[model samples]
Every structure is written in C-alpha cells, then in structure tokens.
Target: MTAPVFVVEGAVPGDGAYVLDGPEGRHAVSVKRLRAGEAVVLTDGLGAWCDGVVTGSEGKDRLLLDVGPARVEDEEQPRITVVQALPKGDRGELAVETMTETGVDAIVPWAASRCITQWRGERGLKALGKWRATAREAGKQSRRVRFPVVADAASTKEVAKLLAAADFAAVLHEDRDAPSGALASAELPTSGEIVLVVGPEGGVSPEELAVFEEAGALPFRLGRSVLRTSTAGTAAVALLLGRTGRWG
Candidate 1:
C-alpha cells in the first residue's frame, strides 16, 4: 500500500527524529494503527514533503518518526481553477473534495444569480471553512503534496474578471447550440491558468453567460448528458488533467 500522508504545520526538519503528535499523531498512531517500523509521509501541503519511518508509537495517541530529507515538488503547469457556483446542502463540500482529489489548482466559490443556496453572514464563513477543510482532508487522502486553495466567495462580476485574465477559460454549459465541442480536444496552454466556470442548479443565467463570454470564456460541454453542478467541475478537471498529460 502507498504510505499514508499527514499534514504538518511550520517547518519539517530536513532529516532527523521528528515528533508526530497532536490530532495528526493520534490519527496515525491510534486511528491508523501505525506501528513502529511502518512507512509514512509528512507534508506541509504546499509542495514540501518528506518520507518517514515510524520508529516508535506512544500509548494510544502519538508516534515518532525517523524523517528523511524533505523535498519540494514543483508546481505543475496548465494550472486549473474551477469557479464553482454554490450548490444546495452539503453538496458544496462534496464538490470541493472530489475536485481537490482530481488535482484542481484552486477553487472559487461563486454566488451566481440563480443559486438557491446563498452564503450570508456567519453561515457563509462556516460554509467556506467546511470547503477548505474538505479540500485539506481529500488532498491528504489523494497523496497530494500541494492542496488546492479555496478562495473567498466571489460574485458574478469578480468571476468574470478572473476569466478575462485566464489564458484559457470555459463555462460548462449544456446548450446544444451554444457549447463549443469537447473540452478534452480544446487547445490548452502548457503554462498559465485555465479557468472553468460551473453554474448553479438553475444553470448559468443568460446574463451571466453573456458576462462570461464578453470576458472571453467560451462555453464547453463535458459530454452528452447534463451533469449536476456539484459533479461538473470534477468531471471537467479529470478531462483537463488527462488532456494536459498530467495523468500520464
């Protein structure tokens, strides 16, 4: 099995005896049952990573590791950002988790005009926190050294500005007459940002689509069937990763 990955705050020693404690340590020692001599990994969740051997485990809540030299992975090219409109219920978190695992570079939560779920006041703050937490956990599970960033909620105008600045941009719309062919075959830049906008359950309002298009974002379709707002970003990202040769 692949060595499990755990997040670390602050600096991780290049190579030495490092204490793996606190909630992470408990998860490794007690929950994961990591025993002495087992292999593990530690990451700062920003590309810096180190392999470790579990040298000793304490009682039921912690462990120590013989950590190796830390190394940083260079950020991959064709950075993908998904502008995901708010979905009702916990599906926002679901979208975040899957998209993080699928290797999205960043996620922008948008409050589209037609969104049924609105993020307001404390509820908005809590929802954003949940999305970030879900991304962190999913990144660990997927063994990603660099976790995706969940930015502050954006408005339609802000989203349009983002698309206008991107090297390549696409809005995942399903209109037969509107969508431009398969996103997989679309020309993509090897470097720079590729932003994909996913609308709400009611889909992108005509006004929203016009704003995006005027910003130079073309409409693209993932497949024949219409997908839910929560799943569209993940599916689009998977295609992009494969097309960009990152999945190779």
Candidate 2:
C-alpha cells in the first residue's frame, strides 16, 4: 500500500533529512503510530511532496525521516472548477470533500438566490473554513499530491463573471423544457479552464439562470435522474476526468 500522507507548511527543500513535527508530527507519532522504518509521504498541499521512511521519534510529538528527493506533480490540464451553490447544513463540506477526491482543481462556493443558507459574518467564515478543511483531508485520503482550493464564497454576479472567463462552462440543470443537453455530449475543453455549476436544493432561480446564460455557461444534465446539490459536482467531475484524460 502507499504510505500514509501528512501535510507540512511549505515546499520540500530538496534531497535530505526532514523533520515531521508540530501538529503533523503528533498525528504521525501518536495517532498514526509511525515508527522508525515505516514509509510515509509528506506534502505542502500545493503539488509539492516527498516520500520518506521514518528514522526516529522525539517524545509523542515529532518524527524524523530519511527522505529522498522532493518532487511536484504538474497541475492537471483543463483545470476544472465547480461553482457549488451552498447546501443546507453540513452537506456543503461533504460536497467539498468528494469533489476534492474526484480531482476538482478549485471550488467556488456560490450564494444562489434559492439557497436557504446564507453566508454572512462570522458564521459564514466558519462554514467556509470547514469546507476548506474537508478538501485538504479528503485530498490526502485520496493520495492526491495536489489539493483542491476552496475559494471565498461568490455572489451571483461574480459567478457570471467566472463563467464568462472559462474556456468551457456548464451548469447542471434538469429543465427538460429549456435548451439543455447531457454532460456527456458537450464538447469538453482539453487545455484551458472548465467550469461547472451546481445549484442549491431549491435550484437556481430563473433570473439567475438568464444571467449565467448571458455569461456563456450552458445548462447541462447528468442523466434522467436528479442528484443533490452536494453530489452533482462529484459525478460531473468523474465524468470530466474520464473524458478529458485526467484519469489517465
């Protein structure tokens, strides 16, 4: 099996001995029970990583490692970003977690018109922190060398601007009457940015849809059945990963 992964604070500093300490060290020594000779990986959560074998431990807080060279994985092509309308309760974090594991490069938390939960002041900031934390944890769990970024929450007008800047933009919608198509049939971008929008439980408001349309984000569906706001982004990402050769 691959070595268990832990996060460090900065880029790897070349082939040498490195100390795995502080909170990460505590997790390694006490929680993971990492001992001398056990293989482990460390990352900065921004593409830089190193693989090493544990060499020793100091108390219950630090672990030493005899690591080889540090290397970085290139950021994936057709950088995928999800514009997720905030879900009610903890589902927002769930959405962030799964999408990170599925290889989403970045996430934009959207405050859509129909969203029941609003991000305002301290509570909003706390919730955003949770989403970012979930992404980091999930990225490590998936053995991803590069973690997804959770951007600050976006307003409807801001979301439209993001859509306008993407090489390809899609919004997950179920309206059979409106002009929409399956995600499988859309011409996915190969090199530039690709943005997909996932609406809230109450769905995207019609007026907001018009704004996104004007910004060039096409409405697309996954299949006949509907998916929750939390899960739709993951499924869409999986499909894009497969089609765009990112999974290769």
Candidate 3:
C-alpha cells in the first residue's frame, strides 16, 4: 500500500525532517499504526511536500526521515472557484470533497433565494469545519499542493459583492436559454479569478438570477439535463481544470 499523506502547517522542502500534529499526528500514530521507520509524505497545502520516514512518536508526533529537496510549482491555471449553494445534510460535504479532488482553487457556500437548508448559529461553523477537513484530506489524497479554501456562508447580496471582486464570474442556471457549453471552451480572461455560482436543490429563484445578472455574472447552462447541487460544482471544476491544461 502507498504510504498515507498528511498536511503540515508550513512550507515543506523536498528533503528534511518535520513534525506532525493534531489530527495528522493521531492518524500517523493511532490510526495508521506507523512505526518509527516507515515513510510518509507531508505537504504544506501550497504546492510543497517532502518524502520522509517516521523518526519518533513520543511527545508530539515527529518524523525524522531525510526530506528530498523542495519543489515549488505554479498555482493551477484559471484558478477556478466554486460558489456552491449549501445543500441539505451530507450533500454539501460530498460536493466539497469532490471539488477538492477535481482541483478547485476555492469554495464559497452560498445561501440563495430558494435555499431550504440555511446554516445558522453554531451549526454553520461546525459544518464549515467539516467541509474544510474533507477538503484537506481530499487534497492530500490527490497529491495537490494547495488546499481549497471554504468561505463562510454568504447570502445572495454577499455573493454579488464577491462577484464584483472577481475577474470572471458566471451563474449556472437551468432556465438559461442558451446551451450550456463546456467551461473550457468559454473565452475566459487570461488571468485573474474565475467564480462559478451553483444554486440549491430547489434551484435559483428568478429574483436571485436577476441579482447575479445585475452583478455582471453571466448565466450559463451545464447541459440539457439538470444536475443535483452536489454534482454540478464538481463537474464544472473538472471541465475548467481540463480546459486550463491542468488535467492530462
């Protein structure tokens, strides 16, 4: 079996000994049953990683393997961001996980006009934490150097504000009259942020679409068939990544 990968807090070199802590530490010791001589990979979630061997397990978990030299790669092209409307139950978690694996640069939880599940009180923060954790694990598994950011839930108005700050923004609507073409085929700006907005289960209300349209977000269709909130964002990310030449 391949050695399990873990994310650390700081930048990693291709060679060196580093420490693991928190959940990663627990996994290395308790869950993975790693002993003091096994090899594992560690990443800083910013395109830096090291191959090292487990050196110690006392106190805070520590790895003493000789790290290879550091390698730094440019960030993914197109820098796709998915502004997904929060789905009920585990759907949001599933969406975030899949998007991470598919190479989304960031994620924003959107609360739209037709959204039935509103994240409020402590539940909102809790859910956000869970998604973040899921994203981190997915990134490690996919060998991605960066961990996708999960923004706090935003209302329709807040989403508009976010779009104003972005270079390219589009809202995925089923009612769009035009055929939803592949995002890769779309003429995107050479550089700057790209944000894709996805609606909730009930879908984006007419008013919400108008709000996004007024904010300069072009409406795009994903295809003839409607996709669940969970699948749309992941599918969009995969297309964007492939178009940007990140996917082989």
Ranking by lDDT: 1, 2, 3
Candidate 1 residue-wise lDDT, 1-248, digit = tens: 89999999897666899988899999998889988889998999999999999999877777889999999999899899999999999999999999999999999999999999999999999999999999999999999999999999999999999999999999998763654447878899988999999998898988999999999998988887899999999999999998888888
Over 4 Å off in model 3, which ranges?
A: 1-3, 10-15, 19-22, 35-38, 55-63, 180-184
lDDT of 2 by residue, 175-233 (tens): 63544336887778789999999999887888988999999998888887889999999
TM-score of every model versus the real structure:
0.97, 0.97, 0.87
Model 3 CA lDDT for position 3: 67
Better of 1 and 3 by lDDT: 1
Tell me which of candidates 2 and 3 scores higher on TM-score: 2
Candidate 3, 1-248: lDDT as tens digits: 67677877766756555567677787777777788778787778877766777777755444445566766667766688899998988998999999998889999998786878778889888988998989988888876767898888887898988787878888888777866574546777756788899988887888988888889888887776889999999988777776666786
Which portions of model 1 show Cα errors greater than 4 Å? 179-181
Clashing pairs in 2: none
Off by over 4 Å in 2: 176-181
TM-score for candidate 2? 0.97
Total backbone clashes of candidate 2, pairs 3 or more residues apart or in separate chains: 0
